[model samples]
Target: MSATSVPRARRRSAAPPSVDGWELFAPGIRGEGTAARRAWRSRYVRQSAILDAAAAAIAGFAGYYLWFVVFAAYGPRPPLWAVLVFPVVWVPVMLVARAYEERFLWIGVEEYRRVLNAAVLVLALVATVSWGLRLDVARGLVVVTLPLATLLTVSGRLAHRHWLRRARQRGEHLQTTILVGSRETVAALDEQLQRTPEQGYKVIGCCLPSRERSTGADAFNGLPVLGGVTDVVDVVHRFEVDTVAVLPGPEIHGSVLRRLGWQLEDTDAELLLAPAVTDVVGPRVHIRPVAGLPLLHMERPELTGVRRWTKELVDRSAAAMGLLLLSPVLLAIAVAVCLDSRGPVFFRQERVGRCGETFTMLKFRSMVQGAPKLVEDLTRADEGNGVLFKMRHDPRVTRVGRTLRRYSLDELPQLINVLRGDMSLVGPRPPLAKEVEKYGLDMHRRFLVKPGLTGLWQVSGRSDLSWDDSVRIDVRYVENWSLTFDVMILWKTVGAVLRGSGAY
Candidate 1:
């Protein structure tokens, strides 16, 4: 062979050619540093600080007042040293409880639980110390302080919560988040955020993971697609993203995911995982380390023994007491319905109850005498779907019926259903026989327990919720059934009824 025809051994390139190519494109790509971006970043920072200070101030004041109570009851207040040290202990406890976390600050049971636990611990320690020191402390002082501190601190947080909620309504101080996922998943998530922007996540852009390059013009609900999955890290940096939600998808690999997590370290942006479990509650998920791998254990929700008895007792007691306490209201409603329409004071409907058992569920009549048969005539005009039949403004509704439905007073007679053991104070809302007939297999799982007078559906968004969302909430409640959760739902139910939120 000629010398010119002989091939020379080639040396490897010092760096990958891809790196050089990327370098050329890097400077031309713009990131999230526009004026709106800077404003959003600053607003979140300011909000965080304000909320933190609010938490600290409330906690501190509570601690001091509690100390004062014990001091006053003992005939002489504690020395300045004890008073100063009291708030010190409270601050750490509050921080540990993450009372400063924004999500728990507004009308959540978490905040109250933390506050109560911390207060009880602090007071218990003080009592022990007083006994050890032989300092005379009166019980009244402790008792008085408990109520005083709890009242003041809770009231303060509530006031702050109101202010923050109003601020959100005016479109001030919200976290700008970038969702990274497949086109379909991100699009669905973007829809939720768009509908409820007041929940406080502003979608800046979508980082869609596609096999092919995504045009920056591609949009989900009008939000731009900044780049494809391969450009996620770059997009994060470019967008100055406060939060990155890795929504449900199979495109991301474990190694690539770990790399993404590593890249997020020390960045101001928060990394959130939106696992594919659509109807799971937080309490049911437990993580345990096994053989160097973190495994999540999901406990089956079973109501038996104490839990069953507790629920039954709660149902009976609450129903009995409610019937007695609301007797006057019931009487008034009965009179109003009688005077406003020809319908009976009470309406009786065949409903599917526990374990697919059919029973008569009683409620104060909220419509004209023969409304059920009218449902057939209105089928084409039905504003609801699947098992629900809702009309925002139904013609069959009497003047009194509208008021009764709006405040949920019509459902008060379900207390009788609870007494008969066909219903619960809290569970899935009872379904009509016709509705139950349409149940798919998964839908029947709701009947494992007795139907409820009020439930996750009632407390969440009631008539306003879509069938899917309602079913998801019910499934979550059933899967994560706990006494604590039941208590919380009942508490929320009160607020829902009072606010007339998601009612007729």
Candidate 2:
């Protein structure tokens, strides 16, 4: 008998084994059951609330001191009671905004977005109450408190998310998951989950379609094939699964899925439905209920329009401001580069931009003189993800160049590219002319937007990513480009550059 095969008599039974008392409890509540299945989620949520409250209190008091005690010493000040009540109001507002929900936590921009929205709402409420009651609320206090509260709250959430990600990476606080779908779909989802362990999914097994289950086969993609589609609940019980992710397919649909949801309710396991769509994000995907059925609606990618125009405006403005602010640093780096290497301070190369337009991309020179001429001799030593030439310790790099590359100081000149509208602050990686020549039809999607100074590629794995992974990330960015997404990438870029793991 196969390892996944159930006995013939047991397979014939429609009713499953009686649910244990521990499995009957609500989500986020601890029960007497498997040690691994304890409710870490409840503790995490409680910790988040405490952190948010603490952040709000600190922001409120700090804002009060800055506005009333220091800056506006002689000006009319709000009562101390108002400052004390600020956190009391702020925490409830965030709760109402669903900022602490598990779905929005540990991943995505939704959590931060909600926090900002809650801050805005609180500001509006404060304004309305002050006007209606003729209260002596200082405008400065309101202005400082709300923004500070939002910032501190977001920072707190980020810290929590970082801690959670670190824990997940170490194989702690992970959701033991089971993939339910055809072998092909299950394998694909498993591959993606494996790539992002911080997402907290640990796929222990899979359940293939009944007809597709091989008699002798017990494993797929290094994961044990637990059973057929019908065996999901049994497998969940036997393994004490935390999550069951069902991929879209014909084998599991209509009443079968509805019944599966009903069955899962009797246990602690949560059901997840993975749409067939790939590379699309939450903002573009919406669910519409029509005729009493939930229908997944996908919005077209925003390639152009007001949002794109706003993005372009912000990119150039930010680049110009960045150049102005970092001028001293840039000049110092230029002098150091010229002193350390007998070459021009700036390196200019032709790179493909939006709509296949060629532009002169600028970078603070990080390679020895005539480095391009040495490419042929060093081709055999290339450790890059093919198509690009990368060497961990390239002989062509100067002493100062290595440090510049490590901290990404070499890319500072790309601000000029952004100012010239040849690149964006955040977008796809700027591909070389030679690299663009090898592009496939799907890869051309990256040209839909201006190449970026820092992007998903830079923050993700940079030079360490495989060629396919690089292309996939770039194309995905193009497909799901948004202002929020860009900000998130820029934020992550700071940490990525600081760690400097994948930089060559």
Candidate 3:
């Protein structure tokens, strides 16, 4: 064997699993000691620190510059020192808000929550201070800064996440993990970790229960068997593992978990339990310890209420303003479609809407005249999921139609639909009358809300989604509808459309 490969190979075979119960197949201990791990982890942390401070400082300075200098709003200016001092004030506010908490960094929406929370508190504090201390600051500056600061921070976070994901994809700054659960569960969990390598998990080995260890296997689903479940502590120390992922199974009971957590208190390894229930995001799932049992409380589905009304108000207002602002672009598209294809400038199709109602959805014509008649001929060669027809290079799409569809310009007419209350700015994609006919009972849940101009389907692969995935995404959207969720989807939609991903 080659010299480098020999050392790694020898380490993997160095010792048998402990007689007590866990396996220890970690090669990382010898190659990557605690010092090495510290060096590797600090790279991302340093990058995050720099970006966080820059975003806050930029937002603070820009807000002051725009209101006091550019527009020169008609109001008494605060002391000149305040402009210079603004960013410095926000840095502490963010620190107090726990904006850079290590647990929240590079994962979850909690980071975004903290950043925005800091912005809100800062604004409220400034208003109170200005009024109470006779500082007479213009109200307009406060108003502009709230959104500007929050937006800039969110932007910086997204860029950092993208950069970190690329780094993780290359196998950098990954947390070493050891799986502790049933062979079956560990195998399944291994698949999950592999599927999302961007999460930066490096599953080095596994610890199976005693009953399942007699299989005479060196590995479980390609992950080395470190030792028996009882040897979790030894294996963790030996590997210097950063995380011990305990998958769902009867073997890892509450007492065992508590003890494991206690033992790991002195070690760097963190014990993470993978709950049996999956696909439920943090917003819907809550934990409350009632009588010592960590009972998971599931929030009821938000089908309609004040939140829905607020969404409706925002949708209509934005749509009306969008139509007025984009009138020139819309007119240009209509003229271009007219010149490219022998079809009406616009195409209207009957689609299933909220509560099983039907409405005419509008779009610029991106197909030849009477394209519906060609569906029968193209049925055998349809590229889309069986229910929704999509063609990446359909002969019926004109040159201009192709260009329009690429960037979603064909969807501009849907702003009118949004204004008319027949659709939302974000929701499930409207199904055709024929497509709805194929609906099973579960599929009907998508009609619980207004059809969307662009939705989970649009931003998450659009025409590329499988039939099952399309239904799943739409149902998930219905069950977890929220204004915040809608805003996030809309923001992602811009990047999705810009890349022309999954658009026909």
Candidate 4:
């Protein structure tokens, strides 16, 4: 305080940051670490249970099937030499096929493929060893067991998958999910959560960005947006938030968000970026690291190689099978149609199929004889994606037509279109010529593959989907075409048809 002496400038200490009660912010009313531990425990417990059941099933089947093959081949254990085949050859084949892998145990199509691979590989090894050793392996036994066991194993796995799916529906085992985003983002996330309940993302709360006015204490969609960007680390530690979905927005600065992500490194929490890129799939997004920046690159649709072969095969096989199987049904429908409507059994409409090609797509006449003339009058009443004309209860529909349209039975005649190679078992649903005319350049890619009898649009809420949603699904399909994907979509189509969802 001496005037002559320079007053020592008082060095100010930084104020200590305020902290919320850890218990209040804990995830699911449990302490943060405890909640995480519980979640981890639950996951392993469920997995172990599944693994135990799978192991038992595989072991039992493998043992019995081996016995049957051995007995039938060499008649009640011919020699130690013959018996040696089971362990050396068969077991290795099973392992190579990944029959014991958890991924294929209850998986669809992959399970079937694994079973086939296991059987074929085992049999091949058996043959090779038999030939090399000059041992007569009974051809009859191999022939009978190969296809039969493969079918049985696949069937068994399918049955188990059904039970597992049902158990999940009943909420036997579910994973907890903590969403961190705005109300709209959380709500959108919740919608996806509803659809895939089996994935078991139990939304604990949507952690909101902090408020400037007061301490962060708020809820979005009944789930707490417990804290904001600044307090995220604390929120994670406090809430035991397992999955932190950083929903992209303006309020959270990119650099600050990056720092928060870095802080998450030490925690057990998984950080997920919920990019606003809706409907686009993983195969499309390529991440390019430019200096320190992560650039997201979307590749244009490429249809080539095995995809072309698979598409060709699927189109041929499915179309042929559909035509043959539906022939009788088509005949019956034809008779009914002729009787009820006094019009041609088949309605041929000039629809735009793959690559701007004009195809007379076949359909069971769902409208009156002169229905095309009525388009002008119905134009104003269009309920379709603006470009397409549709009515939930079109007045032009015949009595038989109404029934056909209800279950998408009218579209059944597209099997003929399929057989003609103008359609596929799975592709974008063909657009009408008028609809195609209105399409932007992006929409044109949908025509790259043969149009389908049933497609993403059909199974994914159909008429209920917005134009953008429909377009996106179509585009996604074009960009990510695969035989396995096509089969899955076709399988879902059966359920969708049975439910009559979104079909008018």
What Cα-based lDDT does every candidate model obtain? 0.70, 0.84, 0.80, 0.67
In model 4, state the lDDT of residue 471.
Answer: 70
- For model 2, what is the error of residue 21's alpha carbon versus the real structure, in angstroms, after optimal superposition? 26
- The per-residue C-alpha lDDT of model 2 at residue 426 equals 96
lDDT of 1 at 411: 92
Q: Candidate 1: misplaced stretches above 4 Å?
A: 1-89, 92-117, 124-140, 146-151, 158-162, 191-198, 212-217, 220-223
* Model 4 alpha-carbon drift over 4 Å, by segment: 1-72, 75-172, 180-195, 204-224, 247-268, 273-300, 372-395, 437-442
Model 4 C-alpha lDDT per residue in residues 1-504, reported as the tens digit of each score: 111122212211223122343233332344335344445444543553454334434444454456566554445435434433443444445667776665454434565676677777767776888899998765655665455545555565666667666766776444445776666776667666666666545556566655521554344444555566677778777756666777866666678778878999988777778777655664667799989788777776557777687678768887788778778888898889999967788888888888789889888898889899998998878776554567887899999888888888889878778777888878898877777766777788897888888888898888866665677678878887777678889899999998987787
Estimated TM-score per prediction? 0.79, 0.85, 0.77, 0.68
Report the C-alpha lDDT of model 2 over 1-504, residue by residue, as the tens digit: 221121211111132222232222223322334345547777889999999889988988899999877796566766776677887898889999998898888888789999988988998898899899998777887788788888899999999999999998987787778899988899778878877889988776788897877564666556667788999999888877889999988798888899999999989888999999878886899999999999999998998999999999999999999999999999999999999979899999998999999999999999988999999999899887667789998999999999999999999999999999999999999888888877878789999899999999999889887776777799899989999899989999999999997998
lDDT of 3 by residue, 1-504 (tens): 211121110122334444233324333344675567657556666666676667666766677778889998877777655654666777778888987667887898888899889988888899889789988777777677667767887888888888889998987777788899998788767766765789988888889998888986876565678888789999878767888999867778888888888999988788898887655565788999999899888888777788888999999999999999999999898889887868689999999899999999999999888989998999878887666778888998889989989999999999999999999999998888887877878789988899898888888788877676677688888877888899889999999999999999
lDDT of 1 at 168: 64
- In TM-score terms, candidate 4 sits at 0.68
lDDT tens per residue, model 1, 1-504: 221222222212333223223322223222433344346434543554454345445544554556565343335655544434434565566667665555565544677777677677767776898889997764554565455655555666666666766776666656667888887777667666664656667766677767623443354445566777667778767656677888766677667678889888857667877766556665677788989877777777776788899899989998999999989988998898899978689999888888888998898888888898898888777666345778888889989888888889899999988987989988998887876666666677887787788888888788777666666677777877888788878988888988997787
Number of colliding residue pairs in each model: 1, 0, 7, 3
lDDT of 1: 0.70
Considering summed lDDT, which 10 consecutive residues are worst modelled in model 1?
2-11
User: Which pairs of residues have clashing backbones in candidate 1?
Assistant: 32-238
Q: What is the lDDT of residue 130 in candidate 3?
A: 79
